[model samples]
Target: VAGDEDLPVNIDDLDADFDPKEYDRRMQQIFNDDYYQKGAEEDDVPEVSDEELQ
Candidate 1:
């Protein structure tokens, strides 16, 4: 998505001149929670709130 957006940092400029550690953090922060889920929802909540018992 290069040239698509004009920002202070260029993600692909790692070899050229850019702090990967800083950029990595920024990128993660931007997509944190909003872009992706923290983890599997099922891990926290059970598949069934209440299962039928025989």
Candidate 2:
């Protein structure tokens, strides 16, 4: 669509320096932080025992 049509011309404009590792590391860090924070807050809630229902 945009300029990415099959109109190849020069190799200099090509972005062959793409890195997926950096992107993965950032996503993992954000996920870990959110998971730990939620766990800490939920620990205060009461839990029902197996025998409580009887």
Q: Best TM-score goes to which candidate? A: 2
Residue lDDT tens for model 1, 1-54: 234243334545555556779678867765566334434452486455454432
Model 2 accuracy (lDDT, Cα): 0.55
Which ranges in model 1 have alpha carbons more than 4 Å from their true place?
1-17, 37-54
For each candidate in turn, the TM-score is 0.32, 0.33
- Candidate 2: clashing pairs of residues: none
lDDT of 2 at 49: 94
lDDT value, residue 5 of candidate 1: 41
Lowest lDDT sum, 10 consecutive residues, model 1, at: 1-10
Over 4 Å off in model 2, which ranges?
A: 1-18, 43-45
Q: In angstroms, give how far residue 50 of model 1 lies from its true place.
A: 28
Give the whole-model CA lDDT for all candidates, comma-separated: 0.53, 0.55
